[model samples]
Target chain A: MRTPLCDRFGIEHPIFAFTPSEHVAAAVSRAGGLGVLGCVRFNDTDELERTLSWLDDNTDGKPYGVDIVMPMKVPTEGSSLDLGAMIPEEHRRFVDETLLKLGVPPLPEGEGREGVLGWLHSVARSHLDIALAHRPVLIANALGSPPVDVIEKCHEHGVAVAALAGAAKHATSHVANGVDIIVAQGYEAGGHTGEIASMVLTPDIVDAVGPDVPVLGAGGIGSGRQVAASLALGAQGVWTGSIWLGTEEYRSLSSSAGWETAFLRATSSDTVRSRVYTGKPARLLKTRWTEAWAQEGAPAPLPMPLQNLLVSDAHNRINASGDPDVVAMPVGQIVGRMNQVRPVAEVMAELVAGFDEAVAGLEKVRG
Target chain B: MRTPLCDRFGIEHPIFAFTPSEHVAAAVSRAGGLGVLGCVRFNDTDELERTLSWLDDNTDGKPYGVDIVMPMKVPTEGSSLDLGAMIPEEHRRFVDETLLKLGVPPLPEGEGREGVLGWLHSVARSHLDIALAHRPVLIANALGSPPVDVIEKCHEHGVAVAALAGAAKHATSHVANGVDIIVAQGYEAGGHTGEIASMVLTPDIVDAVGPDVPVLGAGGIGSGRQVAASLALGAQGVWTGSIWLGTEEYRSLSSSAGWETAFLRATSSDTVRSRVYTGKPARLLKTRWTEAWAQEGAPAPLPMPLQNLLVSDAHNRINASGDPDVVAMPVGQIVGRMNQVRPVAEVMAELVAGFDEAVAGLEKVRG
Candidate 1:
């Protein structure tokens, strides 16, 4: 489980866990692997800073990372078009009618909302601003390479900057932009990903960026054996996101019980890669919500911020409905491996042990 | 690398090579991996038996396998509708127009054709019939599990029966039907495949089929490193196909010079998993011919034998035209890793050496 990255990142193992819950992040950091707190849900800048402060205190001086979603180009294409108006009436009506049909109740009175996810709003800038101000050991861009200035700023603060790439070309582009690490996120990965498998994508990106820059393999990875396979694919570490969703720490966080239950029952074939989540192709748990968007006569999802804007409220309703069948959550195919909820520390330990056993098994096979 | 499968199959390595060419199959067996000859294109039973006899003479008594395509359901559906009538006229015209547009020449006047691939003809059954008479060490089904009688006969002859599965459920079902080995083939593989990737699918199938039945991890595997990763995922061996297409032995077989050149110049991204091949979804090179089928107003590809009947001639024409960009062939994402052409012996040597290096690296990282 150990790699050169384990020494550089000040971690006991080469596992890097990506999770949205600050508690899960803290627990993972405390356990050994680097816990990257996803900053996409922090709508308020002060809230993000306060969450980081909480992670700082809870992790007991252990190093952690932060991940923010930032696509290369803004969804509002520099035009004066009102962002809210960008969504067609039919799309809005489809969301509204679907929520009504599914019996998902509206938010409680006085709970105002504006697209809960963070890619489009001005707060996205603040998420990075606050992340930089915090004591994070690394920064990662979920959508693409962060700005060159951001890379330079992180380097100045001695914080490593990694960007997720779904293709070798994207990895090369990230390398050119001075990214310290490249996470080769594959087609089976949650959130936005391209059409390549980790088995093929990891080696492709590793060769594309050369041996100097470290690559973390992502997608369909939830076991120590997969971590070992990632290394065999020439990755220095593994960047995992989906498995953490089922951890007890994460279940006790913001998400409802329904979200975790759906993950436990689902198999590898259950997830679908559709643009229903954020108007970008992402692998999400196949629910009535995603299926509605794919049905005939359903309006096409709007681009980026508008799509997130249109469905985030409905998402809030579904997650709040306490129904496991209709909950919407981004997850990888490895959900099949997440059979039960356990502590993040246990998950981390199992990963390390699995990797050691896999390595020993490799030696036996090398006879 | 030596795995239990190596001992069982009487080979030096755990590599299972799948190739349609007899020469490539012979070379792989001679090089110590179990060579699996694809019997899809063998329309003549006597000719197939003669090819098997030649393989028997050439392999130096080394163990080899045979792969035949036999979907559980026949394409004709036992209906009165003529198989020719099943393919819409629009589809036939589209293929003809696309080939003409691409300047792909027709086959030589005297060379007749009736869909050059398998899965639709009586020869498909005869393929298994003839194989049972041969000395093949193993028999595999490309599409699904072979008939129970076939499995029974193979077991009686002390020959193993393997079935390729793209999902865990399929593997369990294969095991239930008495397959001795389960091959978990992932999405990034060439020809027929499912949506799941090897990283997730391999482990899923291994657990689904249980440790008692040995599983062979397939797809996105071309080198020794991938082979090691397959074992780490709990597979006893790795079944490889597309990489053999680039071997010197394969190039010297029936394919055109144009076909060989396309495999050399392409990257992983250059392949597309499209149903344009044999009606069912199979990964193929992204060429002008495939693109033509995706254009607006293009007819949807027919299913099964109808689809194969509709365009096998187009495939024949494309390969016969000697155009590198438009030649049609089944391939996997590992085509990107195939930078040069080499003999089967050299490729086999590199795989063994690479497996050793990967294993050593794994031990080094276990700090």
Candidate 2:
């Protein structure tokens, strides 16, 4: 009954919950699964410290981890080889012109917030250091392959390094680069992903990597039956994100997280991936933000940092306005099946139950 | 620039191909994007003289049609579905005993191939009789759909019809009612299709369907940029089985094909639809398939006619397959990048060139 991952991670269950909230992590860990915090939204080292502290207090030492964004290619368009020195005059002017044309409010002069996406590596590095200091069980890199420094640092701390892959090649790269776990994410998964669908991706990744490194199937998985399927195809566990969006612990739930709601209720027609959020394509509830960028003549957004900066304030404003049409909520196509919010434990229990029922259903047909 | 089908049916191309060398009405017409033929595999008809003679001469005089067997669901256990129904009682007894042990292979022999599903509809009904009478445009139909009456009558009028969908929805009853188009398909296609791999099935049915219906795109179209791609998506015209397989062909493709390949090919680890194929859940290349069924002891395959015979194949296949993995691939996962095969004309030209290019470059990418 023990999963390969459960044995490797020293956990009781193979379920891995991804969230940006501390409460969710603590709850998942307390319930006998691993809870991995997404580091993208945190402001700094202090925030990571406080969040981890809360997780520590709440779960009473249950194992959990942290996820960060690491990309393979840095933008060659804006800044020079030195990121700060690279923002070209023409590009900066274009950014200004675009914000002005879009009627966006400017940042207050002298305000201390780093430009969105700015200091990404620095902040992530500090968080990793903070996480290492806290004795976390794992450290994950989202977006792309982690930098050598990040991998090296984590190894020094003896923390298991995990990387999220949208394809088999990525999984291979992760394993090659010293990652302990690989998250096989499909397009239906919430947030940024490649075009390969999950159904096809799982087995391919499993076949590509085989039975050594524990591979966790992510994106679109919300039930125990799905978990069973992942396992059937050689996944050691299931890494889920969308299910937690609607959970009570998620910070965005209080405001009716647009993506969570849309996905839970969408038919096939509703979802789309657009570069509206962070330049790179990400699946989310189809909205004007996505539509606007998809129109015939819109200029493509710059990659990550620039794109992130371009939309950060827009997202904040859209959030404040409660305009579902314009808000950006990274989600997977599977959000269509996530119709209700439930406790993490309940969610885990249902997945287990569903897996059993599906197995039995198959057995019945066989009979 | 012109094709045998186009010349035969007096339309555009010469792709007629599919069927058991039996029915050829819809095969001829749809072979070039115009007509479809009925099945002629099981030889369930009479008055062969009139049907063959008429279809032979009628061309609209355009090329006529014909269709036959191409099972979507391959038996995972309990013997290959192929081996035919003539197995001795001893073999049948062995099957029963096996069921008593491992437990699988639903449905009895007599009730097995009913209506459009049984060999009678595909092989008998003298589809050739009617085809010769009318001399149809094209012929088509795979394992999921195609009624006998439709194939026979179409032959009488010399009209064409095509049939083949990886998903049941794409295998609409209206299509089998009388079509002049036939598609020998794959998972990369934008429309409904069986779970069989396009690479595996395309060649099989090319022989199975007999160069009559001119099988077109079945799954995952890659490029003009994929004819450079179909050098991968695996079929002609990108039957484009996914949404935006062509922007104009949106609705038909979207039901079963989402953007796993379109928006994020690099992200998905692989693709598979599972029974996700016809409500029976066949494996697709991506999305839910990877996450839902990539595990150990997943759902067992059910008997074709009985499985969809009971559940709503068209409706559910449409709904579930588009989710990450629960439902996917009427064609094949190779179609993920089929976001654009470009114009049909470009795709055709590109296919020839791309195939050459791929063969030429094989040595370079091999290692």
Candidate 3:
């Protein structure tokens, strides 16, 4: 059961669980594998700090990590709107009108504005800085390579820097830029991914990086068989995201509402990549919102902060309304394979057992 | 514009054209790119030999290659029938009865008695042997790794050995087992592919294998921008299959009428992977016959040789009947983008032009 990843991460297994909830992360770490808390859902720095504290109190000193979004291509130059400027007056009016028609009230003027998507980079960095205060063994940058400062800071603190890459070029960039671990994410992975299947992506990343830097295979990994396949492909470990959403820890989150339940219930055919969430084309359960945006008459969404700002309120309204067909919940096509709410610890156990069984199946043929 | 692939393959570009028709392959080679003849349709030694000879004569000394189907896993083994044997007698009877009811006469007994799919490897080997004899610069094995002997023979002849890998692990196997180049094919690629999508697959393969083994990116690469992106992601070249189907060279042999014009017409969603072709799930245009196999009471098709044998005659019947709904044509999702009918040379020119434009687009952003 031990692997290079387990040895490096000092865990029983190299399986790294990714989740929006700190509880899930704590639970997974306690169960022997590492869990990285997702930073996307945290409304502010304070919220992230509280989550870290909770994780610290609960994990009994088991090692866990923090996952943040630091896209390689940022709106560094040009008059990139700072969340507020990106949201058009017309777009806000449209959302208000639509929500009013749907009988949902807008957040009372200044009330909800306090914790809205303010400065994504700042928020992520703030979370990272605060997380550094905790006993996290790792810090993962999702969507792209981590910033040089972040990587340097993590290394300075003796914490490992992990970065997610959808392609070998990105992995090369991560390696060159000093990432200790690379999450070779496939397109079958949830969230923002460039097009590349895991099977083709994993081994290439490993080869491109040579034997020095270890890669954690992410995307569409649910079972132990998949884990075994990842390792067989040369990845030192597997990083999982969608699998956690179907687990008991994630089920407790309110965001795991009607839409996600439906997404978790559907088959692989149900997911679609649309610019409905975060302005980037990402795979999510196909919903009426995405379908509506796909129509000819709909406005072409802007990039990054603009597009994300344009639809942030609409996404909130949809989630609040419990409309499965309208909510923008990030997920991969693998969500279809997730049917039941299993415990994370039990899921980890099954993954190990499943991996053994898969290896056995292959060994039978090999013999 | 300059990559090791272009230098090694002796082409103006690193695009390798995949075509079922020898004429198309010859034309692509003449137009300054490598043209690879797909050998799946050549069912026997004689047919493959004749096709290879024709390609040799027509290529005009321009570099060209031959691609053959050699799957990584066989559903049936030597004994106990496996999946193929488990295919019920009733299902075979149903296919026979359906053909009879459709008023299609069977092939004359002993006229073309060799099983349709069983001879693929042997037939492909004959083609490879012929290609090597003619001193082709390259030879490709589609679906999976080429047989160990095939790899050794190609190496002995100083011919570059290329294998299509749908995942990074498969790519690693090819590299480790001594393949010179890898075609990192995505799910959007035509023919047999595992479930991983291309965007994820390409990068993973690139990373796993390292830059030492140059990868030819495949799947959904119809335009120059995609080719540029492939290069950007660490692929040395692009292997395009579906883009050439609508070219004038291909249209000349378009005698099949058992498929819909829409299936022939381009749309990304037109193709689906079903077990209707070669008993292995492959992406193809959806047709009534495919639907029939998936209907509520449909019988499971026999694996490979048997299923291919069962349908070859039926395809002839459907073609003769001029019903497009019943025809099974291998295609990829990129077929939708291949709308215009043009000369193969013209297509090559457009691709290079498109690549230049894409590079320009990126440069503009960079500036």
lDDT of 2 by residue, B174-237 (tens): 3435544445454333324443333323433433344443445454343222222221222333
Superposed by TM-score, candidate 2 places the C-alpha of residue B305 at a distance from the truth, in angstroms, of 31
Predicted chain A of candidate 1: TM-score: 0.96
Whole-model lDDT, model 3: 0.72
TM-scores, all models, native as reference: 0.97, 0.55, 0.56
In Å, candidate 1's interface RMSD is: 0.9
Best of the candidates, lDDT: 1
Q: Fraction of true inter-chain Cα contacts (below 8 Å) kept per model?
A: 0.83, 0.05, 0.07
State the lDDT of candidate 1 residue by residue for B306-349, as single tens digits.
Answer: 77777777877777777988978889999988889999999888
lDDT, candidates in the order shown: 0.86, 0.53, 0.72
DockQ of each: 0.83, 0.05, 0.05
iRMS values for every prediction:
0.9, 15.9, 15.7
lDDT of 3 by residue, B1-367 (tens): 5567777878767889989888899999998889998777765667767777787788877889878777644333332234346557887777767666555556556644334553355555566666677757888887667767778988898888898887677789989878889898777677776665654566568778997998888876776656654554457788998778878888656665444354555345456778777787788776666666777777777766667766676776665566655566788766655656788989888778766654543332222
Question: What ordering of candidates by TM-score runs from best to worst?
Answer: 1, 3, 2
